[model samples]
Target: MKQQTKHSDARRPLMAADQSGQGARQDEDASKRSWGSEQLAAFEDRLRHLRLTPSQQSLASVVLDNPQQVAMSTIHALAGELGVNESTISRFTAALDLSGYAELRSVCRALANRYSGMLWRFMRADHGAEADSESGANRSQGDGKDLAGKNGTSGQRERRDILAAQDSSSIAASFARIDGVLWDEVVTRLGHAEHIAVIGLRQSQAVAAMFAYLLGLVRSQVSELSAGGARYLDALRDLGPHDCLFAIATQPCSKDTVNVAQWAKSHGVPVIALTDEVLGPLAELADQVLIAGTESDSVLSSMTAPVSMVQALANDVAAVDAAGTRAHLERQEALLKSFGAYADKDL
Candidate 1:
C-alpha cells in the first residue's frame, strides 16, 4: 500500500498540470524568463513526490516563506541554522537547473522587481479560479471524503509538473565555469603563496584539509584549520603577514569561518575564498573570491566544482615548481626505500 501511494504521488504533478492549463503555461513562461518561480515550484513538487530529506524540506520551507529575500548569499547560514552543510544549499540550487545560488538569487530578484504588479494580479486571479474550480469539482463529487481525496491528488500533481519543467542547460553552464579562468586564478594564487592556511568548518573543512595536503606536497608550509572546537583557534594564532588564508565557505554560512577570513584580512594576510556567490559576507572580506558551482541533484552540497578548483590549484603549483618538486620526491623516495618503507612483499 505504501508503494502504491508513493507511485500515485509521483504522478500527481502531471495530473495537476493537465487539469490546469493556466498553471502549466505560467510555469513554462517562468522557465523561459529565468524567473525563479518555475524553479521554486519544481522544488516544491519534488518535495511532494520524493519527500525531501528533513533538512531539504526545511530549506524548501524557508525559501518559500522568503522567496524575495533568500539568496545564494544566505545558503551557508541557512544550512548551519538547519544543522546541514553548505553543499546541501548548492545541491538544492542545482536541482532547480540554476547555475548555482547566485543565479537563483538574480532570477528571484529580477522577477520580483520586474513583474511584481503583474505577478500579484495573476496570482490573485489564479487562486480565485482554482478555488472556484475546486468548489465545483467537490460539489459534483457529492461524497465529502471522495472530494477530499481528489483535492489531495490534484495538489500532489501540481507539484510534480513544476519539477518536470526545469531547464538542464542552466545547470550545466553553472558547472562549466569551474574549468575556466576562475580555476586558473585559484591555481595562480596557490602557486604564489609563501604559506597557505586552509580554513573551513564542517563539510568545507574536509575540502580545506585536502587543499592543505596537496599544497604541502609542493610548498611545505601548508596547514588546515581543524573543525569547530577542535584547536583551530590555536592553529590560526600562528598566521602572519606573508601567509595566505584559503577559505572555503558556502551558503548557510558559518560565523567562525567568516571571522577567520576577517581576522586574516586585518592581519595583512591575503584571503582566497572558494564560495558559491559574490554577495556572501565571506566574499566581501576575501582578497579573492572564487565562485564555485554548487548545483546537485540530492540534498547534499555539490563539492565537485570546488574539488576541481583545488585539484587545478595543486596541479598548477606543482607545475610552477616542477623541477624542485621532482628532486624532492626522488630524495624522499630513495630515503623511504633505504628505510624499507617501500619494501616488496617477498621481503
Candidate 2:
C-alpha cells in the first residue's frame, strides 16, 4: 500500500510536470527554491508513515501552524500553551532529530527566512553590510575586500565568492558520502542491462528524464517512466532481473516514489537511488544509493553534483563499449541531419 499525506493533492503536482524538458525544467527549478514549503510537506509525509502519539501530533500541528511564533517562544512558554511538561517538549525535539529548543528555533528561523525570501539576502548582508564610518548607518561595503583580498570588494564579487564557496562545500559533501565501488558497480550494470527504466516523480522528473536522455545518446535501451496512470506499474511489471530502474528523489521525498522502488526490489529488479540524505526510505530499498548534497544558503538548492554524477556514469558506459558507442552517435547524427531535426547550424 502507498502512503500519502493529508495534503497530497496540494503537493503531489507541485513537482509533477509534463514530458517536455524545456518547460518542466523551469518549473522544477522553481519548486526547489521553496525550501520552507518543502519542509512542511516532508513533515506531513513523516506523519503519515510513522506512528505518532496524540501529544506529538498536537505538538507538530502547533509547530507547523506557526513556526515563526514557535521561534520566538521559549520552551517553557510553548509547554504552558500546550499544557505539557517541558520534558515532553524536549522529547518532541529529539524525536524530530533536533538537539533542543535552540536548534528548533534555528530551523524555524531558516524556514521563515525562506518563506520571506530573505535567507540569502540576510546572510549576505550579515557579513557584507558595513556600518558607515561617518554617519554610522548600515551600508554595503562594496569596496572593502574581495574573496582573496586581492581585488576590490564589490557586492557582486562578494556574492559570487560566497556562492562559489557554497558550491565547493556541496560538491565535497557529495563526494564524501558516495562510495566509489558501489557507484562503479551501478555503472557497470547500467552498461550491460538489456533495458533501463528511469523513474522520478514530481521535481525529480526533470532529473530522471535528463539522465535517460543522456544515456539514450550513448545507448538505445533507455526509457523514462511516464506518470499517466497504472501504465507505470505495467512498465515496472515488464522489467526483469536484466533491467535496471534508476530513480532520483530528494528531501520531502514522495511516497509514490518509494512504492515503485519497493515494488522493483521485491520483484528482484535492481534499483539505484540518487537522493540528498545518506539514509532514508529510498536508500533502504536501493541496491546502490548515491547521496547528493542539496544544501544551499540561497533560495534554490543546486543539483550540479547529482548531474555531474550522472554524466560521469554515462561517460564510463561509453568508454566501456567505445566502438559500439561511437557507432550509435554516428547513426544518431546522420538521422538528425537526414530528417532535418536540427533548427540550424547553431543547433
What C-alpha lDDT values do all the predictions have?
A: 0.58, 0.65
State the lDDT of candidate 1 residue by residue for 125-206, as single tens digits: 3443343333232211112221112237775574334322222322444455443555555666677667788988866777
Pairs that clash in candidate 2: 15-202
- Please give the range of 10 consecutive residues that has the lowest summed lDDT in model 1: 1-10
- lDDT per residue, candidate 2, 179-199, as tens digits? 667767877888999899998
Q: What is the TM-score of each candidate against the true structure?
A: 0.51, 0.58
lDDT of 1 at 78: 49
Cand. 2 Cα-lDDT: 0.65
Of the candidates shown, which would achieve the greatest TM-score relative to the real structure? Answer: 2
Give the CA lDDT, 0 to 100, for residue 176 in model 1.
Answer: 54
